[model samples]
Each structure stands twice: as C-alpha cells, then as structure tokens.
Target: MIRPMRLVSIEQILQARKLLEGVTRKTPMEHASDLRSLHGGPVYLKCENLQRTGSFKIRGAYTRIHGLSEEERARGVVAASAGNHAQGVALASSLLGAKSTVFMPERAPLPKLAATKGYGADVHLHGAVLEETLAEAIAFGERTGAVFIHPFDHEDIIAGQGTVGLEILEQVPDVETILVATGGGGLVGGVAAAVKATRPGVRVVGVQAQDAAAYPASLAAGKPIRLKEMHTMADGIAVGEPGKVSYAHVADLVDEVVTVTEESLSRAVLLCLERRKLVVEPAGAAVVAALMQHPGAFTPPIVAILSGGNVDPLLLLQIIQRGMTDGGRYLKLRLRVPDRPGSLVAVLSRVSSMGVNVIDVEHSRISGALAIGEVDISLALETRGPEHCEEVARALQAAGYTVV
Candidate 1:
C-alpha cells in the first residue's frame, strides 16, 4: 500500500525558494472576481499559464538542470515531452548555455515543436505515442552520456514545481483550497507538499482528465498503476501512470483528486476564453472544470492554478468551433422531403426567412431513411446562439414538412 504523503518541511521549501532565486517567475495571484461570484465564493487564479514557455514546467526544469554537477552540465541534457515540458527544458537549457536535445512524439503539437526549436533544442520527432518517444529519449541519453531530464518523477523536479505552491501561499494568505491539474502527479505532488507544509489545514485538490486518471486507480491499488490505454482531449495530462516520487508526495499531502469529463473540459476552455480572456490548453482547463462540476466541494477563497497555454493553432481553432457548437451557435440536422425540383428551394427559403445562415447543404437520394419518393437533406447552419437555434428549430417544425 502507498504510504501517506510525507509533509515537506518548511526548511525544504525555504531551500527550494533560495535555489530557485532569479530563476522562476513570481506568477500572479489575481482575484477572479467573476469566477468567485459565479461560484458564490472568493476565487483566486495562480496565473502560471502566463509563465515562461507558457507553463509551470520551467520551474522544475530549471531546478533539476541547475542542480546537476559540473560534469553533468558539461555533458548536456536530453528530455522527452509532447508540449510544455519540452519547451520548458529547451528554454531552461538554452538560458543556462547547455546543449539540449528534445524527443517528441510524432503527433506533438506544431506550436510546441516550434517553441522547443525556438529555444535552441535539437528537436527529434520520434514515435507515434509519448511512451515510444520517452523510451527513445532514454536510449539516446544512455548512448550519448547526456542527462535525461524527466518530465516528472524526480525529487528535484518535484521540489522545483513546489515553488508554485510557495508563491500561492504568499499571494493568497487566506486560500483555503488549492486546485491543480494533474498528469503524472509531479505538479500536484510538489504543490501539495509546499502548501501542506506552509498551511497544515489548507486543502490541496488535484484534477485529472477522466479518461487518463491513473491517480484514482493508483490510490485504490496502493501503488502507482499503469493503464492499458487512455484517451482524453487534455493530452497534457494523458499520462498512463503516476510518477513514483510524485505519487509518494501526493498520497500524503493532497487532500483529494478528482476527474472531469471531456465535455466539461471543453466548456472550461470556452469559459477561460469568454470570461477570463485567457487562452488555455485542455489540460490547463481541467482544474476550472473540476471546480464548476463540484461547486460545493470547495469553500470560499480558493485558488485554481491555470497551468499551461501551449496549444496548437489548428487545435485551438477546432476547440473554438467545438465550443461554439456546444454553446448552440452551430447546428447540423438531417431532414427528409419530397424529391421534387422546388423542394430544395423551399427549404432554403424557410431557413433564410428565419435569419439562419446556411453553411452547407447536402442532398442525397440513396443513403438515408427516406421514402422512395423523398430525398434526404443534411444541413449545417449558423445561428445567433442557443436561443436562436431553438427558435429556428421551432420555425422549421411549424412548417408543413415534418422536421426530424
């Protein structure tokens, strides 16, 4: 069975603060008045989404890299990550004038790859999945005598990430609860340690994408467990297993861990864009989603960490479209109508009269649940929003043709 989390001492946190001097950014702890009022409590946001490389990964990367001996630094560094961690390590290594190589999965986001390259890392695209890429990085590190910078799973990296917790305590003195997104548990483990050490009563909650939640299962199994397969839009936290060191810390310090659905995560992404005017990746939005899903779980004066913002432009566009659809701004429907010449024109005229802009329309006679004398019409329409969409649907229903 996994032992309870060991409380990190205040001295350890102090040492981490000193070691991280001039390295980590003092990320803002801003009062999210809108979110607070929406939740009927005080809510603060730890804006690590604005941190260097667009995530808190830099804190750990710098701490781990700087802690290396002269010989290790001289030999250079290597790491594997799909997004933020790759950029973090690359930028940290560049700033330290150390040679760096980053192994990324083939499906890694283009923007992350670009950012890693921009930070002067030799970017190597390998493997279809993160596991393959990480395995390749380890092999490369072993063969070349270069240091393998793990994304998490190390004491130094965990301690480094703990700095965020340190900043939160200083910035939000009354913070009763802290919410963070989790993957391999590094950030949550580190943050929990720091927070619990500083304020013994403060609750540190971890969130995970529902599909990739290894922590919950690990906690049940009493050890870090691996999943046979996992899938989630929050790919940043799509780790199959919890990190050993991170699990140890979380088991003791974190108050609890929760899982969020993909739908809620999508909405949270929209929430950040619409209300907070922030661009957040899916994994980063999970914490916000968790708070919204379990409203009464946290009391007032809570802090939610916005972890990263390194999303691909194309993926961002798709997410925006998905959000719009989810919000009822876009609608797709299939209908059956008489297979006659004026039938298509009649449908268009009816839809246009309702001010619904037709985005696309398809007519098919061979493939749908249409009678011998009828045709199937599929349409994609743009409406003002959900209300307008419902209005359009009502208008269509009122027409003589049966609406499906």
Candidate 2:
C-alpha cells in the first residue's frame, strides 16, 4: 500500500530560503516585450537560466544537503542525473564539505559531464538512460553508506525548490499567471505550494514536453504513473514519472498542467535567442512555447520561468535550423532546369530578384527520374516568413521552371 503523501508547507519553504541565502543567486526577471505582444498582456521571464550551476537545481540540492546531520554529511552524497541536477548536487556537496558521487547516462552531454566533474563530484557513467543510471547510483549509495540525494520527491527538495516561487512573488507582486517547466513535478509543485499558501489567488500552470509528458495521465489517475518509454529533445524535463510528494502538491495546488509540441519548443528557443538574446534550453523555453502556440490561454502579467540554460552546442545548432524551418524562415526546393551553365545562374538571379537569400545550391544531372536533357537543382533559401516562402515558390513556377 502507498503511504499518505505529505505536502510541503510555505513555512518550510521560507526556512529553505533562509538556508539558501548566500548560497544561491537571486536570478533577475526581465520583461519579454515580444511575448507580451503575443499574449496581449505583460509578460516576464524569471531568468533562473543564470542561476548558480546554470539552473534552479542548486536551490533544492543545497537545501537538502544542508539539512543532513553531521554524521550523514560525513557519509557523503550520491545522485543520478543526465545534466542539471548532477551539477547542482556536485557543487552543493562541495560547498558543504561532503564528497559527491554522481552517475550520469552514457550519452549525457559532454559539457554537462565536464561541468559536473568540475564541481568536484566523482563522476561515473552508467546505463543508456536516466532510470538505469539512477538504479546504479542508488545501489552505490546503499553499498557504500553514502546518502542518496534524490533530485526530487523528498519534502526537503520540494521546500528548497519552493524558494523560486517566493522569489517570483517578491519580484512580480501583481503577477497573475505563472508558467513553469515541469519534468518530475518538483519545481512546479513547490512553486504551487508557495504561491497558493501566500497569495491564494495566483494561477500556476505547469508546461511539459508533449512527447514525454507523464503528468497529465498521472493526474487523471490521481497517482504517479510510470511511463515505459520516453523521448524528447528537452532532456532536462524528460522524466518518466512524477514523485509522490510532488504529485500530491501538483494535484492539490497547481491550477493546470499543459503540454507543448517539439516544433513549438524549437520556435520558442529561437525566439529567446534571436529576439531576447537569451540562450534558453528547450525545456526552459516551454513557457514561451505555450504562450506562442496558445495566445489567449493565460492571464495577464505572466511570469514564465526559464528553467535552465545547459545545452549542447551541437544540439543548439540543430534546434536553430529546425526552428527556422518550422517558423517558415527557411525553405528548401527542388526544380528541373535545362542542362546548361546559364540554368543555375537564371535560377539564382530569379531568386535574388525576389529578395530571397540562397543558402545552398546543388545541381545534379544524374537522377533516376531526370530526363536526358534536364538536370535537377536543389535550393536552400531564406525568406521573411511563410508568405515570402510561398511567393518565392510561386514566382519560380511562374518563371517557367518546373518545381519538382
């Protein structure tokens, strides 16, 4: 039988805030004019992306580790994470003079792995996914007598993460709706508890990646349900299940939980990069994605948390390209032209005349379906938007070129 869940209290969160003083940064809140324009109300970003260890994980990690008795501290701490939590635990343990052991997935990003180790943790690579890695870490903790530092689920962790909610309320007193990126529900649950206990009027929404969302089903069942498989580029929020403590808080306190598509996530990342000059990871951009995809779904004076900024550079490049394509700023086309030198020039000139920038061009005469006297040309063009892309395609077709 499942034990009754104990919800984190606002008083506990306040105590956690006192413990976190001088240990964590009060990350800034910035106005998002572009999101405001789309939302038709004031919008702001809680920039936890700039927090210590590059995420709010530090708040919970430090608070939890600090609560341990002296004897437990001497035993050290062990944790499992793919990225953010590992760095948070490593640094938190180091600051508190405890040895930390962190187990990460085999395919965890190189930058995150390096950062975790740099924070003085004994790093171990295990398993193909987070679940397997977590198993190994737990076993290690049990065998070595080290304290198992859970990334979420514990009341202390929830209380610690609740500090973000306190900071948000203090920063934006009149904020109506607050959107938070959700994975295992720790952050959202803590925020909801704090906000509800204090204001009792603010609406709190949790945003999850659609492909890996487990909260909706779990909430429907009124229990934490484990997913057999999960996949999403927003790896930070790709948890397979919610912890019981977090589930209790979410079910009781949060106003709503919503999911955003991968395409919208990419577009949100692009918007933060190009428009706001902020480097937000896909998970961190979930709130922005929700606002952009559903314009009127939220209330005015919204505060969206930018959960983390730890992203692989290679993945960033791919997301940017995908974002451009999804936003209709990039267009790819194949056309049939005469097998002559002027054919390429003619197409380029026609494209340039319409103010479209040609990113790449490929000409091939060898194709299974190409006629004897014809060549197939592939073009990668950039345009202003969807309308411009359509105009460019139509103009090419009208210029007597077969847009294959």
TM-score of each: 0.90, 0.97
Error of 2 at 234 (Å): 0.7
Give the TM-score (vs. native) of candidate 1. Answer: 0.90
Against the reference, the lDDT scores of all candidates come to 0.87, 0.94
Q: Tens-digit lDDT track for model 2 on 1-404?
A: 24566789999999999999899999999999888877789999999999999999999999999999999999999999999999999999999999999999999999999999999999999999999999999999999999998898889999999999999999999999999999988999899989999899999999999999999999898788898888789999999999888888888899999999999999999999999888999999998999998898999899999999999999999999999999999999999999987989989999999999999999898999998899999999999989999999999999899995
Candidate 1 wrong stretches, greater than 4 Å:
2-8, 30-34, 335-355, 363-377, 384-387
Worst 10 residues of 2 by lDDT: 1-10
Per-residue lDDT value at 56 in model 2: 93
Best by TM-score: 2
Any runs in candidate 2 off by more than 4 Å, and if so which?
1-4, 367-372
Question: RMSD in Å for candidate 2, one decimal?
Answer: 1.5
